[model samples]
Target chain A: MALASETPRPRTWWRRNQQRLTPWLFLAPGMAMFVFYVIYPIIASFRLSLYDYDGLSAPEWLGLANYAELWTDPAFTTSLYNNVLWLVLYLLAVPAGLFIAIFLNQAVMGIRIYKSLFFFPFVISQVVVGLMFAWFYAPNFGLLYNVIEYFTGKGVAILADPDLATYGIIAAGLWPQIAYVMILYLTGLNNVAPDQVEAARLDGAKGWKMLWYVILPQLRPATFIAVVVTVIGALRSFDLVSIMTNGGPFGSTRVLSYYMYEQALSEYGYRMGYGAAIAVVLFAIMMVFISGFIWKMVRDERGVH
Target chain B: MLHLRTGAYAALAVLLGTTAMAQQRTLNYYADFDPAPLAAFEAAIADFEAANPDIDVVLQNFDHEGYKTAIRNFLTTDAPDLANWYAGNRMAPFVAAGQFMDVSDVWADNGLDQSLGSALASMTIDGKQWGVPYTYYQWGIYYNKDVYAQVGVEVPATWDAFVANCEKFSAAGIDCLTTGTSALWPGAGIFDYLNLRTNGYEHHMKLTGGEIPWTDDSVRATFAEWAKVQPHITENHAAIDWQDAATLLVQGKAANYVMGNFAVAVFKEGGMTDETLGFMPFPTINPDVARAEEAPTDTIHIPAGAKNVEDAKKFLAFIAQADTQTKLNMALGQLPINAGSTVGDDPFIKAGFELLSTTPGGIAQFFDRDAPAEMAKIGMEGFQQFMVQPDQLDAILERLEAARSRIYK
Candidate 1:
């Protein structure tokens, strides 16, 4: 009895709380990593936005100067405008993917082969896609150039024209993004309730009505995922712009992410503070959509429970 | 027991290895050299090592593009004894940040002020020499002789004659001037020549030094000269790379290319023999202005944080030697910066040597090297924009002026 009373208090406490503490202990390592890499950097970037640093010398405090400069900077404005264009145009991938998914979701012979072929683009690296598309749009001897020349008597170099370069890069990005969305919807379509689909078909619901009323409702999870991925992809578009245009023909094709890189780290750029300010703005823009997504997810979980 | 004995043996071996390394000084060199130049540099290092048997030189080669970013990181965190960089304002940032060691004493000891005189000004910042220049290649018009002959045109001696030749070339459906601005620096080469010719070396220096406003009238005058050939430049050049444009010149679709001597190799590789390829000085734009040339010097500097400063300085002195530079540039197929060094028998190298040696006006580094980096990027983009849309000249100038105000301050 004396020994039982003298048992270490810490061990007893651990025993008492083991059920709750075990999960948290398991989560500790991952949570620590998340705090160090993700949370810390976000806060650091916010603080860095107010300083004037060139990545070599000491950072000078500048208050709101970096943010204020962004408001007046023409390059920043162009990047913002291009980002908006990307966001609007990038959403088109979701519907296009849905259409392709429906078309490929069939029981015909060799449908799997066709589906895989359609999914091939997503598997390829972004750099390769950018290179392929660059060649396709190249002037003089490119395939698209030759075809356009045959039709219009003069080939258009889409990447060279400031008015069209952003669109050209966006089209390249959509090629792979659409493939990714289609794959997601394809998997979603497999789990759909076939009985509901049959009921709608028997009720004389045709193509559009049946899709809108029964199929799409069942594909809500897929649609939500597609929208979220597409939005994130649009916001973080650096690779295609870097590969295809490099914000050239007078920086016309720059998106926010690429512009931030240009301001901070490119061969000619070392304005870390200005880059941080641009990053802060981009983060804020993303937070709006991300928070909306989180709110919706929480509400959906509550409703389900 | 056997495993424990083996582990003990491995530990002893590591300890011995470290002790041996500590006994001999190691000079770490970080360089970004293409295959040809890398071989030349390695050969030079062998000679240096043979002379000083105790000092070991360790070389870490990086890809050219990646090195630009890597140098910034390593210079701060893990500095090497030696680093390869460029001359002029390109090195200004490192100098200003005190990341590069001041090597004036080495220059004084070696009498480099006389032998490396041509690049002396470029290597100097605030009256102190920070690096040693080994090689610089000339920039001029490399033309397709066959294209010139087919168009029934002779190489021009004056700007007007060049403009006239452009009309004839255009009538034959040939691009008069071809450059790829996708990377954006090629267009600056053209601007450099025009600015150098129109305003002479002093004014050009003033303009790039940010003393003169970008929207100044003299700057507009240079643009006005550029306007003459804007339409005759290759269409859709913004989508192509410099090598692709070189292909156009090689195929005789383009008559002339205002490029550095490096393009001569590309021209030769594309099946142009010595007879088919011809080099000429950029024509006399304003005969009154003394002739200036563009020869961007490649240099080596000692990092401030370098551990083996003495051996690194010895390496610099060896690189500055006339014979060493002569042999190095021979392999590099470039012009040696040492005045006493002899150039090879290559016709392009000879022509460049002659063109640069006799220039009364001072030599200007290429535009990107001469100007601050931010200004250079904005300026090159503006040049590309102007090439595509001459109508946007006002907008482009205003934009550059705005950038200048923000960047130079």
Candidate 2:
């Protein structure tokens, strides 16, 4: 009996240290995956940015040279400028989503079907959406081209026009993005405090005023998620641009993501080192927003406690 | 019952082990092809597997554009035994990087040096042939005979006569040359022909090889000649792709399309018959300069890191045979490199074969194939922009010259 008691019983060990060890055991796989996939690649990409590798050969060390070249590259400048335009304009979808959500928030007959219909675009793949928009904006036989020609006496080929191509693609991106945000807001609206809205209505608060002062305050979590996703989506805008324009009509629609792809893998030549530098820049931009969101969440948690 | 089940499992395991041992030599082939040529290659693969029963041929095919991206990754990691590639400067980088095997011994053992004929030189780099070229085709002006008759002109053999015919087409209010520059390569086709005619083949090759500057006087002279005929080209060309431009030719809305012979199939599919569709060589620009045609050849190579190197070489030799080439190219609707290989009775194939074989200055692999891909992209983009705004020539050339210096360095 003494020898048996001296041995380590796994059941007793689990009982004694369960709370401390269980959470960490649960987190181990996820943490290991995040470290391997996300953290390791970021560090490796940073290291690769300082070299000159053509992907098929041994890498040559060229510290800061690739970054230095990017400073004067006309294509890089155009891509960065277009990325800024994308970020600024992509935010318009959030407000547009809110507007659509409010308009359909009523309990009218067959409104459930209408809500599902409104969420339809978000379910379709971005590639299909891009193709649909491309056909819609096609030069001679497209719907938009014909409509424009009927009014202006000249058809506008949106994807083929360098000045307007990015805008056309962003409009395609917004179709699905707006649908996604509207679904989020609709769910948030379902959980809104009705008593507060009714009290505000008694105090002469109605329509835009009530939505602003009373309802929006309750919709803060939804709004925060909407903004976060929109920001990330804007920065990662690649599929629509790739499908519709391919950075064509003189490389005018290229974003940092597409430009990096063109440099790293496209027929332009496999300059992996240069491509890594572009990715680092895009990541740095994304980190700013990511950190801010985390900081706000931490402060909110502390206030709640 | 338990004893019988275990016995059955042991037998099955032994059978699998023997089958695996028998299929020891497996050769992997990575191919990039359009649907039409892919069928031909598939048939050839079947024949090769049947001929060499001991060797197993594993084939993976990717579409043309997707393969371009996938090659860079696969060639370095998990490389196939053999992979399809292009010749000339297209293969130069891989050769320089030591990614492809030096298959000169296969060339010698099979007498490919004689069989390959004109393509042998292009396949060779640094005194060693890197790959075997299977098929190639010619690029020329495909014109509408009905439009030619409507404009009251014949096929012009010289540059001056071509310009006069364009003038007649202009008088008749039909665009003489319908090209799609939205994709940017059709415009480069025009630039290639003009340079080949004016400055000759050597200079054109040198320019694409990045030995000559974009702002050189010869290049400027080619552009000057091109500008003279710019008004005859289709307007608002940036809006449509090559197929749409070909549609204009099929509809008789445009007179001519300077493209590869592959476009003949498109024209035929668009209801154009032999009487309406005709092929002509790009008109002569310099009386003294010999004609050099754009005939891009498609080649296949064995990767240096391939596991089944000996079997790969055997496959290469088998495909290098004239009979194999004839069967393959005949199915592909392209001209085979071997003189003994017979192409289809298709008149365009005959004309392409005759033109490429008879040309004094030989062939080029088109702009995109000849030049480094980075420089080619910028060069084609500049060509497209120039088509839109010809007055921006100096600025465009300056930009291209800068890109050339950076890329070639």
Candidate 3:
């Protein structure tokens, strides 16, 4: 009431400029939050990477020492290798998802139910998927163990073997990832211009030829989204690795995300600065992909305009 | 309108007064992740509150693994009045940073020196007691008595007897030790026992303190001794968890397992009784070396950031009482550190009490608790690797030595 009584000058100014300023005013709150939570933290983490902190004492400035240490650290090398493995393996989901989407695209009885059933794993959390897969691969009594033993007379404990553990987790991760991609492709298929398919059929283009020459190019937008999400998900593969192996048998399953968490937290006792360094590396890797995607999107937008 | 505003102010003051009168004080207590212990802890708090009605205890329990990470966050900001944490080197960093309130006065006032003698040294830092030691349990070789009887071998006290027993168990088609190294720490237990038995407790302390290198002769001997038992351990042991390994022991497929006294509950849950389960200290490698056992102690502390110092002190004193310790440990299936507390009739508890109380070289907290956490993580990983491939001892040691030197500095 006091401000209203005293602010005629401010009110007159607002009335004069509100038309031009309304859009920015509307965006201010959200943009400020983004800057604080996202942009500020990224800058802070980069700064912290140059110091040595244990989240307790005052941080000591050791510019580039953490980065220097990373080169010689075998654990870092292993984590980097595993991250690349995850990236390469995770891309397999896009095509697998498209295949499943095509298979389920028919107008059959209870087809909707079948679609939802195929999308079940994606609906559940990654933690649950990891647990289910852990059970499925458990040494003596797991379903996978039983099947393998039936054929070879020896059960394979997939998660227990360090050499095999990361691949096992990646496979578990792909179960839901594939479902996600399938849903995206299903949505894309719905809007895929049915006339084109019919026209291609009239030209006697069918099966793989039809999919390759007609359907796939039309589904590029969905493919783009699937590839983007898969890349992000693969790099952020901490939950399954943490839940299943905890980067064990001997830290063999650590990706950059899990390794950063282990350093920053866990009973390993906060090496926050070193953890920040790892995060910076992960962020730089992610930025390369993000920038490429954004560049393509911008080019597409320009072409559309 | 003026009269109405006056009345609203009067009412607010009255409500605040009544609330303050009704609940005079609150003590925020954060408990560690252990459901059974939390139950007993609640009971103890109930008694304390009844005796001192002015103070109200607000308790929150955390999941064990989550709590391990959350403590670092909460201890520095929004600290609870009292927190449950491990003793020994695990508590050292928090103490060194002055996050924990030194309650030496409480110890003096309550005469806890007499009751908590067993865990005093571990809880003390820089001549001050930072926390109250409540409960601790012993770690030893947990064996299936049925297998031992069938094999006709008695409890082994010397290294030679231990190896011969393992050989006998192996000959009888039972794996000698059923341990899960997938989590990494179980393998460290084997390392702890071997180091304590071979080099004595002093050397073990020196090594954990980073005064001794990993490639030291005494450390090599400890690993060398551990290598002998590697042959008799379960195949593909890293693939299973401790509970799974315990299942093998309970099912009589494996002869023995080395674990903390906590496994007694798991074995009991597996349908084994006190009669079939036997507990023995890790055998002595050097008869002349004083016997130091692994007994991890759990302590309660008032974080320095706490709001209720007086109440937290009172709570700590109440927790240190023999009755409280007895009930807490009894519920948790562990031993009370209170010297005056009676050990429950559970034979395993009795044996643990007997072993820990009588150790001439005193009880060292387990490997993960005794060493700095980062070094401990790397060291335990090395131990696990060595168990899987005994020939990689030198490489593992070199890696551990590198980590240890870097961490300690």
Candidate 4:
């Protein structure tokens, strides 16, 4: 007791100013980057949405006008409807990818090569994929056209029909998106505990039941990733739409992003303020998933300790 | 310490200002055409510098197809000193926004009215001239002589004859028309021709500028006529790029191609020279309206934000000079914009002049260029959808009218 009192214990640097300096120092670079690239742009876009600025000219404020017009615009409705269709159709990729991943998980000769081959579409540029699918669906001479003609006694020019054009583009989009989902599932399958599978098998679990009870339970982490990826992919489905259709065949394939681009910065004209309003709506839609994700992540963090 | 800091900043400022001032002011020439034009521009620049002795010019060419997208992004940032753009309705949005310099004083001061053709009226919107048209060429039918000969049809010079020739070609198992709708602009030209013939230039002006109904009777009639001719067209027009359609002419597979003067190079490159290719004016169905101007012309403008605006203007003015205009187009085989400018000995260029001079009505900017881009897109897509399935015409029109109302509001 005398020794403990005789010499005061030296405090750590953190022990003195840790609360004040630590959060800031840890946050400095990341916070700066977030401010510069993400936060500022969001704020700027929000501010820009209140204007009628064509990018080349000075901005003019017509507050709430862009939003007012957006409400009454038929094109916006068409785009929003198509976006919903993309979201619904895009969810198919996750399950399709899981089945593919499970099928390819069997041990066999050249299985690695087969897996990579399956993964090829996702690795290829979306632009190239769009072009290939376009060729595949090309009216008369396309491979799919020939196959359909062989059976139906007629050639189906999928892209030219406004009724079918959006679906055609979405099918092309799935070619790559499924491949991305498959790769994620393949990774998850590698980490799935074999002990659980063996126990479930001993308990007389059979094919679909085995998967539903044992395999899927172990693959939650991968499912989470796959669902999040699919959601974001569905939301940001612009590149393929641009390359394949450009929202053509009577604007049948126009999504919110492409429509926003068309509104604010297309060869047609610049309506920057109107474009920003469209962007805000899209952001609000995306925020739904983002908030859920954040809530889940926070729950997971709390559960971590 | 304060004095030293002030002196240091003053010296730095002087250094920067002086460096910026004497930096040998290199002029940037951003264009969408081939290297041939840039190469020619350099030769012109050589002579210009030989006279001025104080400026430098740098020529950059983007892939013709990609340049439009590139220029769109570039214009929002620090753009080049001088860039090439289309005149008429194409330049209006840019000019209206004041992104481009007002070259009106330059035009008046240089007596451009006396030098350039009165056809420059298309480039002038709202009484302010924003750019000097470097050159322009008219649009017309470029038919394959071999295919036409095989089908035993002569070049049609009148509206009735044009349809008759199309029927002849269709009967002979040849696709009379081929175009691309992949990007929408190529197919947009089809609407231009239809609208030009059906409604004439004035109605086109009112309709494209959001002044008339997209479902107007005249517009519907244009699509109705297009539907009749649609079946004679290629099976997959979207499969072919505009150049690829021209290649069909070269291959003797197709009967005719309706295109602007820009397509001559493609035909020539494919070995369909003057002897193999024949040209005619866009036949006038309504011979009553005779405005006698030209179609979409190309312009080169110095941006208001250009660092070297004066020098950029000097370069553009030099390009507009009679001697340079003659030489440049002579090499590129384009029609010159200057009134006294000659096409030299190129057959294609000479044919272009004949087409423009003989066509009873004035030329018009292509539908996509002349109309507001939004309305133009809807109208053109409506036409394309109609062509594929004529049953959709009424629904397409009603939808377009809805879009039209929104734009006007």
Model 1 alpha-carbon drift over 4 Å, by segment:
A1-11, B1-22
- Find the candidate with the highest DockQ and give its number: 1
Query: Residue A255 in model 3: shift from native, Å?
Result: 0.8
Q: What is the overall TM-score of model 3 with all chains considered together? A: 0.92
After TM-score superposition, the amount by which residue A10's alpha carbon in candidate 1 deviates from its true location, in angstroms, is: 9.8
Residue range B1-409, candidate 3, lDDT tens digits: 0011123565674466457667568777777756677677777888888888888776777788888878888998789899999999999889888899999999999999888887888888899999998888899999999999999998887889989999999999898988988788888888898999899999999999999999999899998898899999887677678999999999888988889988988999998998998888888899889999998888889999999899999989998999888887777778988888888888999998899889999789988888999999999889877877889899999999999889998
What does candidate 4's lDDT look like per residue over A130-210, in tens digits? Answer: 888877887656899899999999888777667888999999999899999999999999998988888888999989999
The RMSD of every model to the true structure, in order and in angstroms, is 4.0, 5.0, 5.9, 5.7
User: What is the alpha-carbon lDDT of model 2 when measured against the actual structure?
Assistant: 0.89
- Separate clash counts for every candidate: 0, 0, 0, 0
Q: Model 1: what TM-score?
A: 0.96
Chain A TM-scores, all candidates?
Answer: 0.95, 0.93, 0.94, 0.93
Worst 10 contiguous positions by lDDT, candidate 1 chain B: B1-10
- The order by descending TM-score is 1, 3, 2, 4
Cα lDDT of model 1 by residue, B8-96, tens digit: 56567446646777776778788998988988888888888888888778777788999999999999998989999999999999999
Model 2, range B93-173, lDDT digits (tens) per residue? Answer: 889999999999999988889888789878988999999999999999999999998878989999889888888998888
Writing each residue's lDDT as its tens digit, candidate 2 over A1-305 gives 88877967567877989899999999999999999999999999999999989877799999999999999899899999999999999999899999899999998999999999999999999999999998899876789999999999988888877788899999999999999999989999999998988899999998889989998999999999999999999999999888887787778899999999988878876789999999999999999999999999999999999
- State which candidate has the highest lDDT: 1
Q: In angstroms, how far off is A186's CA in candidate 1? A: 1.1
Q: Which stretches of candidate 3 lie over 4 Å from their true place?
A: A1-19, B1-25
The candidate maximizing TM-score is 1
- Model 4: residues >4 Å from true position, as ranges? A1-15, A149-153, B1-30, B59-81, B238-240, B247-253, B268-273, B291-294, B306-310, B358-360, B398-409
